[model samples]
Target: MNKVLLIIQREYLTRVRKRSFIVMIFVVPLLIFAMGAIIALVAKDSDKLSSEQVVNVVDESNIFSDKFHDVKNIKFKPVKASLEQLQVAAKTNESLLILSIPADYDKKNVVKVFSKKKPSLLITDEIGRQMNDIAVNNSMLQHHIDPVIVKSIKSNIAVNAVELTDTGAKDANVGPNMAVGIACAILIYISLFIYGAQVMRGVIEEKTSRIIEVIISSVKPFQLMLGKIIGVGLVGLTQFGAWIILSVISTKIAGEAFNSPQGSMMGALAVLQTIPFGYILGCFLFYFLSGYLLYSALFAAVGSAVDSETETQQFMFPITLPLFFTYILSVSVLFRAPDSALAVWLSIIPFTSPVAMMVRIPFGVPGWQLALSMFMMVAGFLFTTWVAARIYRVGVLMYGKKASFKELGKWFFYKE
Candidate 1:
């Protein structure tokens, strides 16, 4: 235990002191902010490009009744001319593009657009939106239903989900919950890969250099392997902790800079106050540790078995596949129907629970489900550590040959 602690201290300090680690701790958040700024600038530029475009709406059935509203910078000019007249008019005037809604538009819902050149997609999208609104209103009128009543009914529907817990009813807004859930899941996914690979690479570096020979003479192969995994895991946690702190500080500074006289901050920083940071950070630390410990065992084994980083690729695929599969499902399926049977199973399954359950957490998971998932993950990592230790004991001494699945299978049966 003392040796493992020493090893952990050495690994954590070694990595934490590196210039690259220091640079990355600050660089990552800056890159994220820069990316958001670039996207916003691009969107603003696109809006400018689509500005002041004239759209001629020629409605034959008078469905819109000349009540067609302008959207963004697009001007809607309802022309009383025939289609042939409009087409002829469009031929001479390059800027004039005609949108012709036929008399049977209610049945067909087809709006023909005539332009001298191909019209911008933005202009067409706005036109389609206006047509859809008009069609909805026309349908409501045809059924003798009041549009105002329909609008009122739409406005009245608000879903505020509250979870009854030991404390009390908790606010469960799906938007913020979904965001937090996905963020936690993604953090675990990234940390697992980043730190797990570090474990593998560390082993590969020592083994290739024959430094493992000296280390194992003093410590058992299992102790060394366990120490390395735990050490690297702590390094990951340190970096992650720094990122969270910096993110909070940056957000607070931004909020203060943009605070209005009404006490609300401008831009997106206003949203920071509403997020349950303590809850998210608590769950994140637990899952991050669980996920890293779980995957790093296999990564350490892969490192010990292989001669170099390049050879570890073939073995890495299987270890990474489950994480990838759960990530895809979390984004597409789990967020929508978190309590579905498939989601429930995935969340409880040891291999995928770290990602799957985090996504389910914000949506409110059962207490038993959370407890069961944690148990399975804890048991899974212990079992993995045992198996990986067996491989590490024999593989660390091996040299000059590429390992295969057949060879790895043999190492499992070798007596300690």
Candidate 2:
């Protein structure tokens, strides 16, 4: 235990003292903010571009009783003369081109688009299309089409979302689900990237600098591996807690900046302040740590298995496949049914539940279900850590030889 503590202290302090870590902890968040702002600004310009498009709506349906001001970004030109007059005006510099709905337009036939030249991008033929559809649909209705089917076809479909609670008086909203899902995803991505890379770089550094010899002299191989994994995992958590604090502060400031629309801050703070939050957040922190430990230990095993970065990729994606696949499927199914058998089953799978459970929790899960999920996660994490330690014990000493999946599996079964 003392040896493990020494290893943890060494790993944590070494990483914390590095300039790169110092820079990244501060710079990355600012970069994220800048990128978000730039995207918003570009979208604002795109909205203005939609307004810039000038389309002359020539309604030749002749049944037109009112002005066409309701058409978005469309200009209405009521024709007093022939279609010939409009075509002549269309050829002018007023607008690049035009699509004219003909007066003789048969409702059952193709609508004709009259243009002197090909329509420029600044011109939209959407109004022309909509008018043609309206005319055709009007014809169908005039022929007395089935009203029931017509109404059903035109009606909007909505899915009812509700939470089944045992005793809680309050109901869950989509806002919390969305916020928690997004937060959980962010946490998972950051932990995996940060800790996984730490494992890789640690292996590479030890292999290159011959520091493994000194470390091996003092502690057993698996003990050393456990220490490094735990130490870095702690570093990950410390930074994660700091980031959560910073983000909460940022959210508060943003709310003030934006006037806290619909009492968003108060609602968020209210939820955070609840007594159950301690348990919920405790579950989050524990699962996050355990999940990272499981994955990062394997990353260490992979790093020790390989001599260089190029060879590392061959092992990395296969490891992350479970995390990515689980997250996608969890999010996809959360809307269809958050409490279904599928959701219930997935949240129990350890590799998946780090993300899957977090997404489902905001929607509410039964007590036994949450307990079972935590049990599976802890058990799975312990099992993976043991396997990784065995791999590390052997692979760390091996030099110049590449480790194969088959070879690694063989190591796991070896009687040491």
Q: lDDT of each structure?
A: 0.85, 0.72
Residue-wise C-alpha lDDT for candidate 2, range 233-267, written one tens digit per residue? 88888776766676667767766765654675566
* Candidate 1 structure quality by residue, lDDT tens digits, 1-416: 89888888888899989999999999988887789779878977876765476878888888763877877777888888878988887888888888888888867547678988888888888778877887888889999999889887785567877766688886555687798899888878888988999999999999999999999999999989899999998888878888888888887787777778565446345444455678767767887898889899999999999998989888999888998999999988899999999999999887898999989887767889988988988998999999999999999999988999899999999996
Q: Residue 215 of candidate 1: its Cα lDDT?
A: 93
- Pairs with steric clashes in candidate 2: none
Q: Model 1 off-target regions past 4 Å?
A: 30-46, 49-69, 73-125, 136-171, 255-276
lDDT of 1 at 287: 79
The candidate that wins on TM-score is 1
Each prediction's TM-score versus the true structure: 0.79, 0.74
